[model samples]
Target: MSIRKVVFPVAGLGTRFLPATKVIPKEMLPVVDKPLMQYAVEEALAAGITDFIFITARGKGVIEDHFDKAYELETELARRGKDDMLERVTDFMPEGTTSIFIRQQEALGLGHAVLCARAAVGNEPFAVVLPDDLIAGNGRNVMQQMVDVYDRQQGSVVAVERVPKDQTDRYGIVETGELQERVAPLTSIVEKPKPAAAPSNLAVVGRYILTPRIFELLQNTRTGAGNEIQLTDAISALLAEESIYSYEFDGTRYDCGNKLGYLQATLNYGIRHAEVGEAFREYLDGWNNSRDS
Candidate 1:
């Protein structure tokens, strides 16, 4: 079956970004000019996903507003003959795309946020995208690459990247059976294991293409690390029922969940932005020269 629906679990508190995220969602934070959420949505859209299910919480109404039409803003821009600005605001969301926002009442873990979209996702293979992981694809995006693996494996596919062994505690570590180029069959998955206990350095990132059976497993899954439901646990259980493949996606992923990563993403994207790339480069060069002097 063709993967058409995508679930975005955006209900987290984003405590790392505190103060700023107090009002605005972390996903709404901009990298260069575009919001992180927009990038994730564009990636999914490129993968031909039509239904967007956002499992959001309170104060995330801005997210809904961002994707929805800004009537007054559009009208003012149109009246002022700001054709480019008007089009930019109005064209953010594509036609024929269905966006459904469901409130995740509590601050549950990733598994719970995904389970909240059970009704919207129904019983089909769907992709889960976390906007915090801003991936820049060389040609094909991360989600599209995972979908390709899903097409061949026809079970579940998760995106993995080799993190430093010491950083294994920060990610869901995957143990692979054998290396088949970029794709590997997962032998086991451990969530946030210590450096000494980590099975392998292949850490799972935020992109996932999962079958509907995951919802059932998540429902049965008890609280694990941090006393919150973990998606890694459910994916572990899924290994018994079906085969799951881990694809080492080809891309540079910016971990936008923290201040350092956010700044790095901004710098990287600003340097490559179409409108301001050259100017930014010149400014950086002058700044570097002044510092050296």
Candidate 2:
């Protein structure tokens, strides 16, 4: 079945971003001109995902408002002959597509957050795009690449990228078999395993094309790492029954959940913004020259 729906788990407390996130959802942080979540949504749109299921928590209202049509503002813009602005505001949702938001009442682990999306996903396979993993792709979105891989493999596909061996403990590291070029059949998945015991440095990124069978596995999954239901634990069990593959997606991922990553993403996206890139490059060059002097 074609992957039509995508679940975005956005209920985390975002403690890493503290004060600013106290009022604004971390996903609402601006990347360049748009919020971080907007980039993820656009990427999903490019991947042919028709339904957007947001598993959210409190203080995420900005996310809902950002994607919804601003009727009042649009009316004013139209009255003022601002067609360009109106087009930008009204062009968000595609025709005949669904954007539903489900509230995740408690702060649970990623596994529990995904479980909240099971009803919307039904029996069909769907994709999961973590907004925190702001992937900057040259052309194809990371999720699009995974979906294409899934079409051929007709199995679950997760996005993987090589990380430093020492950083394997920070992610769900994948153990894979012989590769088919960029895609490899996953042999196993170890979550936050010690660097010494890690199977490989091929770490699973935040994108996944998962089957509905995972809902049952997630339901039975127990609390893990940081006392929350880790999605890695459930995927580990699902691997025992179904075949899952890892696609070494070509993209640069920014972990917006971390302070350093967030700052870096701001700079990266700012430097790439069409309206600002040239001026920003000049500014950066001048600043670096001044620092040396």
Candidate 3:
């Protein structure tokens, strides 16, 4: 089946972004002109996903509002004859794509957040994209790449990247079986294993195309590390029954959840904008030269 629905877990308190995030949802943080979540939504849209299941929290009402039509803004823009800007702003969601919102009252864990969308996902396979992990590439979106693998293999798939061995403890490390270029068939997954005990350097990123069986696994998943229901645990359980594929995406992934990665993504996207690239490049050049001096 074609991947038509995507689940976005936007319930985290974003503790990393203190004061500012105290009021605003971290996913609402501006990347350039648009919020970070907008990028993820756009990426999913590009991958042909027509349904959105946002597992949001209390402060995440702004996210739903962001995608909704703003009558006041539209009227003001139309009165001012600002059709171009209005079109740009209002064209976020395409027609015929269904968007559903569900509240994940408690901030349990990624697995729990996903399970909250079980009703919407039903028994079909669905995609999950973490807005915190902003990925950019020349061609396919990361989830789209995984979906292609799922189409062929008819099972679960996850996006993986090779992290340093020393950093294995920071991510869900996977043991490899058959290697198909950047795509690897998974044998098993170990959540945050020590560097010396890491199965392989391939660490799971935030993108996943999961089967409905995951919801069943998550329903019974016991709280593991950090006293939270981890998605990795459920995924490990799924691995025991089904074949899972991992694809090393050809793209730049920015962990917007981290301060440094957020800044890096801001600069990278800013420097690539047609309207700002030249000016931003010159400013960076001057700044670098001054720092060196």
Best by TM-score: 1
lDDT of 1 by residue, 1-293 (tens): 99999999999889999999999999999998889999999999999899999999988999999999988998899899999888878876688989999999987699999999998999999999999999998899988888888998898999999999999999999999887879989999999999999999999999999999999999999999988899999999999999999999889999999999999999999999999999999999999999999
> Which portions of model 3 show Cα errors greater than 4 Å?
none
> Candidates' TM-scores?
0.98, 0.97, 0.97
Q: In angstroms, give how far residue 224 of model 2 lies from its true place.
A: 1.4
Model 2: worst 10 consecutive residues (lDDT sum): 85-94
Q: Per-residue lDDT for 1-293 in model 2, tens only?
A: 99999999998878898898899898888887788888898899999999999999988888899998888998899999989878877877889789989999888888999999999899999999999899988688788888899999999998999999899889999999998879999899988988999999999889999999999999999899889899999988999999999998888999998988988999998898889998999999999999999
| Candidate 1 residue spans exceeding 4 A from truth | none
What ordering of candidates by TM-score runs from best to worst?
A: 1, 3, 2
The regions of model 2 sitting more than 4 angstroms off are: none
Better of 2 and 3 by TM-score: 3
What clash pairs does model 1 have?
none
* TM-score pick, better of 1 and 3: 1
Please give the lDDT score at residue 27 for candidate 3: 96
